[model samples]
Target: MTSILQVLIDAFALGSLYALSALAIGLVFGIMRLINFAQGDLITIGGYALIVPSSQMVAELFIGDWPWVAMVPAIVAICVAAALLTERIAFRPIRDADPATLLITSFAVSFFIQNLILLVYTGRPKAAGIFPGLSQSVTLAEGLTVPGIQLVTSAVAIVLLAGLAFFLKRTRTGTEMRAVAEDFTMARLLGVRSNRVIMLAFALAGALAGTVAVLLVAQTGVLDFRMGVFLAVYAFFATVLGGMNSLVGAAVGGYVVGGLSVVLQAFLPDDLRPYRDAFLFGIVILLLLWRPQGLVVGKAGRERV
Candidate 1:
């Protein structure tokens, strides 16, 4: 039916955003073996970076026709810097520490960033000021309408995913990154600079998070300081469902989660709507129990030091 197709489009659009965000999380985990809880906040950072500049109508100062391109670079740069700084300040010292310590530190860093934003920007939601054409709907089939922005978002996500695949497969730095993931000590012995590689990982993750933020703003048209909190949960779930260290797995997991969410929303009765997240959470719990490493195989032959 047309309605079903519409739902599928909606799900894929949302899932693409999730895929990018999850890729950010997965990238950090793949290299440093640390979950950057602040990953979601990097998204929040990207959102606000645009919100603040556009709110002032500052885009008018730049080229009117393609102001968005400028915003994209500026926002992504700010987010990448924030991510790198967070890693250096909060994560680098604890790099060799136990997983528990890293996790707690991540949580703490997340809270610190969120609260800092809240204090500076207030807790109110602000419109993200996306391009005008983004919200336009297109008739894909009889009785089916899909948002123009959603299509663009999905296309962008696919392109970025493909580009990422190419980078990981063909580049020397990418090979070194994979080598580091497989065996950090051996990678170090091979003259792989752990510091530089890890920083690059964080940068890539930041760029992905920034892109997701732009897509999210395009879809929702508004953002709140607390937006990062729920997104973090979603990203964590995607990471669990996909293989934690596999980029492709993260993308697949994101779409799967998005599809499952659409299916549930479409079929769930009114009474169960409120508890949908609870059910999904239960599913994540089960998935983690069954395959703690995630659905896809992570970095091949990882050994705990």
Candidate 2:
């Protein structure tokens, strides 16, 4: 029972990270059928934004050294601006392009951000000691212990999810977003300014990515140029598995994927443990074959044009 509880904690923490990441991707994908590969790079930018770009072993904390109240907003603002800028510059011209074109554009954007990181940070991983206070584990019920990170992450995710749900259900901008997600052409015809809606989506995605970066550095204590790339990938899978068009689905998918991963790690034998991803992916493939529509299908679920 204790073991089960521990696994649950682990899963929730991991899921929280993935859920945030997936939401970042899903937000952009919802507005434009384009997956922003640079979403992960936004995360790297947040982590790297912490330290002065250095080739040396010890990284000098940049904004990371600031008080928590200041540091958090700074990261979020920077990344959100970056995201909005990317939409304006890189993606705007190709807004009407086909999925294949958008896919390539996303790849280009990913590479572009990575190259910038390499040029600045020299491709070397740096130790990031952000929010070290969260490292300690707190005792829970019946001798069980949970890492402060796990609790914080889960709470953050839940709060964000609730806030997002409220925004989508109640706010004007949120209504525009849902309208755009439902049918961009129709929404544009119905008085929705496409550019404004798209910009909002990018901003939201950037905020989510920034938050993930903060949590990521706290969890890993290490920063790397490509750190967020796989996270972006998994989050994409989460969106697909949960229901690409549904933000809630993406969130659920993140939890499911994260939970399944911990479960796999716990059950796999020592030798097979290293191949955990392979097995997990195999399961995903088979499941996809069975339910190609995903676990949760959005009302506007069909693949958009």
Candidate 3:
């Protein structure tokens, strides 16, 4: 029972990271219907943003003897900038293309960004400035163990998800965002600044990915050049499973995939672990076959204005 409980707790934590990445994917798809393959590279960008800073100001606050209130703003600012720049440079030019063309362009952008990173930074992994306590575990009553970082990750994820839900449902910008998502050309024709909304979407993606970068770096205590590739693939699967156009669906899909992956690893035999991807792919195939639209294809229709 303790083992099962531990698995469940761990799954929740892992799910949070997946959900954050998936949220970015879902948002872009919702607005443009274009799969931004470059989304994952932004994660690498976020990781590098947190890594290459020589001052270590944010790192100091996280590890400081005093409260860490100031770190939040700094982190948010860096992430938002990274996101907006990515949009301005990579996505803006291809805005008018068909889905296939945009997707290919996204792939090209992903490689170009990654190569730029490779040219600038060593291909080696670097240690994050976080404390060693992040990986430490605590045992609850009846011998269930949980990692401290996991709890922190889960808390941040829950807060972000709640705030995003509120932003989408209550704000005027959110209403305009929805309008753009429903029909970008029509929305533009109706006086909505589609470019601005699209850029905002990219900014949001960067912010979310940046948050995930910090969490991942904090949890793993290492930063690598190639970290984003794996995460991007996971986010892709999660978004597809949940529903590309549905933010809620992406969040749910992320957790589901995370939980299932962890549980399978924990319970499956050694030989079977190698087949995990195949099993997961099979599940996704089954889901798609069963429900072509996805778990919850948001309420927004695809009609152009």
Candidate 4:
């Protein structure tokens, strides 16, 4: 029973991180009909923002040294700025382009940021000591122990999810965003400013990415240029699996993917452990085949033109 409880806790914690990543991707997809693959790089940038730029392998703490109160917001702000800048410079001009073009543009932006990181930080991984204390194990029972970071991650996910729900349902700007997501043309006709809503979506997505970066750094204690790649990929999968058009579906898909990952890791044999992701993806593929629309279907489909 204790072992089962431990697994559940671990799964929830891991799922929380994936959920945030999914939410970030889903937000942009909802508003722009463009999957911003560069979001992963934005997350990478967020992690890199904490340390002073150096070619050396060891990272020096810059923002990481600040008090949590200030450090968190600083990281989030930097990511938001980066997201908005990309929207203005790389995406806005081509806003009406084909979805394929927008996708390729995202890839271009992603690679550009990645190479830029390599130039500044070099190809080596850097050791980051962001909130090292969170790495410690917390005892919940005689035999059940969970990492402090796991608890914090889950708590943060819950708070952010609730806060986002309230914002979307209650605020004027949030309603405008929802309208825009449902039908960009109609929203514009209704006086919803496209640029404003799109920019806000990017900002919110970036904030989520920044938060993930912080949690990831705290969890891993290392920095790599590709740190956000797999997370973003998984989140993308979660978004699709949950239903691309529904934010709630995206969030739910994140937990499902996260839970599956943990369960596979725990149950797979030693020889098969290396192929856990392969198996998990296979399951996801089957699920998608069974229900192509995803776990949750959106009420109305909007054509992007």
What are the C-alpha RMSDs, in order, of all predicted structures? 3.0, 1.8, 3.5, 1.8
**Ranked by TM-score, top first:** 4, 2, 1, 3
TM-score of 4: 0.97
Q: TM-score for each prediction?
A: 0.91, 0.96, 0.90, 0.97
For candidate 1, lDDT tens digit of each residue in 198-296?
999999988887888777877787878877667777877887798876777888888878777777887789999888888777777787799877787
**Better-scoring candidate (lDDT), 1 or 2:** 2
Better of 3 and 4 by TM-score: 4
Model 3 ranges off by over 4 Å = 53-72, 301-305
In model 2, the clashing pairs are none
Give the per-residue lDDT digits (tens) of candidate 4, residues 66-127: 99999999999999999999999999999999999999999999999999999888889988
Better of 1 and 2 by TM-score: 2
With candidate 3 superimposed using the best TM-score fit, by how many Å does residue 263's alpha carbon deviate from the native?
A: 1.1
Candidate 4's displacement at residue 179, Å, is 0.4
Cα-based RMSD of candidate 1: 3.0
Worst 10 residues of 3 by lDDT: 57-66
Over the stretch 200-252, how does candidate 2's per-residue lDDT look in tens digits? 89999999988999999998999888999999888988888888888888999
